[model samples]
Target: MKKFLSLILALTMLLSLVAVSANAEDITLDVIIAQYGPNTQEWFLGKGMDGSNFVEKFEAANPGIKLNLEVVSWNDLYTVVSTRISNNNAPDILNIDVFADYANEGLLMPVQDYCPEELYQDFFPSFIDQSVIDGTVWAVPDLASARALFYNVDLLQEAGVEKVPETWAELEDASQAILDAFGGEVYPWGIDMTTDEGQAAFAYYTWGNNGGFVDENGEWVLNSDANVEAIEYAIGLVNKGFTNPNPATQTRYDLQDMFAAGKLAMIIAPNQLPTYVTDKEGNVNLATAGLPHNEGATSSSVGVMDRIMAFKDDAAPDQAARNEAIGKFLTFFYDPENYVGWVSMEGFLPAVNSAVGALVEADPSFQAWLDVLGGAKFYPTTKAEWNDVKQGVIDVEQQALTGGNVKELLDALQAKIAGK
Candidate 1:
């Protein structure tokens, strides 16, 4: 830890003498970190996870660079960011899920402009691929999670489900068996079509059926035959009394609670399901399996990742110097010494390979999640039309839940996205 002491000494001198060097100009980065949960605010600014202050350490490491960091809840982040962007006062660094809008709008700096090459190389290649538009990478993943089928083991055993369903037909049969055993006391399956996670509902079935938001060429293909069939099958499950009664209103949180309480026999959820259940004091024998696929289709693990991106600042006098400072910030943030806690604290999988061994050491369960994440298929966030497609699929599902034609709704969405 000699390096740590050196940083401390540098910071002490910088504070007392007010300058590390005559040329060391002070730089303050305005950063907005999304509040993922209760402790995120404390992790970056206060005495939170590990009781080590991130800002203090970062500043000490690089004397002249100060962090004016703000933690914004997900609810207010979009509004706060939008207001700032419109006012041409965007933060130097931002953490959020969707970045295509900012990137396409020319509001974000290319990752190459600020990301350290060694640090950039440490990021998972697949994860980095998701943030690229054309040939340029725009952001880096903060954390990632894989979605899979979580089943109540005791409930399934009692229901006579001999094996975890691997295909849609088997899933339907298992669902029916659970229905027969529970007699309406427990939902055989949980489907979330609420606005909060409706897009995810689209992914569960469509991606499972080998029908996804885009084609192999990354073009919008929402109304393809495969997608129509997938959506129809999902709606069929709800109609057949095999799923939760109110798919349109029941959110992921609601479904998670039901699953934890043994009220839902099966649900598609992330790796953090166990952590969530434990925290909520819900008891159940839970096991996970890949999402069931349709016949002749693929069973794909759905991966979810939120990103950290830097914004363009045309007003900066020294772009290279500013980018270097940003690089140092990233380097510090993802250092295994700091990143392992950030990922583990949030109960998420790491986006960088450097944090893997440490995370798995801390929790063996992380290894299994890492395995699932390896083969996972991500959303097409690289596409400029991603937000529209995300919301469009949700709308299509909500309408179909209300008896609208799934095929017709998807066809309409396809045309809308195509500007037809």
Candidate 2:
């Protein structure tokens, strides 16, 4: 009887160990984050020797959780994410731009269900509104960005321009003066007429000029008088020798590099450029100003936000468990302390309003960004129509700026986007 009892006890212990192992296995989760462009390697892998320490810290805090990260180039982010979704093999979490494309699709999970309402209210209304669609919050604003004018003070001084421009006419005058002063040795401005950056810049200028990309009924309105005038003004800058020769071939990076090297007097770029400029010890005299508006027009520029998305279908049998883990991670990431690290390191404005408090207390240089966010506006919302409209606008603007007829280009663009 004693031998039989001993055998029974051993078997019971073995069963309990097996059950524990199963529970541990069930707790592990797979998460994928997309990092693209020049910033990808930094964002995912971290900057210097502390490679993936953030990921390590996260995993250490959450027992039995495993994270799988893949670093993808920015060029392939959209394609890979889209293909995964179409193949019914999406990641547990994904990062998406704060445009209408991903939000319009029902691919992302509503974060509001997992996050607290108070937390949700902490973001700027415009920031929150962009992520909310069809009465559901599909994503959380991870980062927010605003456009500004970056000028080389030395160049401006060389041109004998006492102050940077605040209006369209002032910009033109400044440009012309710079042209006369430098005499082809330097370009007065370096504006990108490329597809992505140029379209965004053009939209802001046109909107500031009282034109917009879409009407109340969602029709394309790029051919409006205000837009035409804005495009003409942009082209006029080039004609007056205010812009670099052949801006159509210039990319955003190229323009920024030129401005940083003091080759260009002025450039329209994101507020984050200051961080990059400061890092390179390029020029301490660099100053950022709000984007100039059309004569007698209000100050307005295109604002963009980045968001974190999670798919419900991808969560599978462990949906609730995975959602809980993701919610915790997001909360931790957005926590005022941890969030500041990411934002400051990444050189992006914080999406959380509470983070503004941290920024003020920690880094005063970012105060200007907080002010910029107060009046920022996002791209118009449309389901699956963003890419089409964006491409159409770029095509038209490229043609118009490259000696093509502005009226005909705008007309064709409007018609093509409107399906006319």
Instruction: List the pairs of residues colliding in candidate 2.
Output: 36-74, 37-74
Model 2 sits at a Cα RMSD from the real structure of 5.6
Tens-digit lDDT track for model 1 on 313-412? 8888888889999999999999999999888888889999999999888888888899999999888888888888888888999999889999899989
Candidate 2, residue 145: Cα displacement in angstroms equals 1.5
Which portions of model 1 miss their true places by more than 4 Å?
Answer: 1-24
Q: For model 2, how does the per-residue alpha-carbon lDDT over 237-336 read when each residue is reduced to its tens digit?
A: 7777778887677888887777777778888777788777765567747887778888888877567788877776753666677777777767766777
What would you estimate as the lDDT of candidate 2?
Answer: 0.74
Cα lDDT computed for each candidate against the true fold: 0.91, 0.74
TM-score on alpha carbons, each prediction: 0.92, 0.87
Q: Number of the top candidate by TM-score?
A: 1
Worst 10 residues of 2 by lDDT: 44-53
Q: What C-alpha lDDT, on a 0 to 100 scale, does residue 284 get in candidate 2?
A: 40
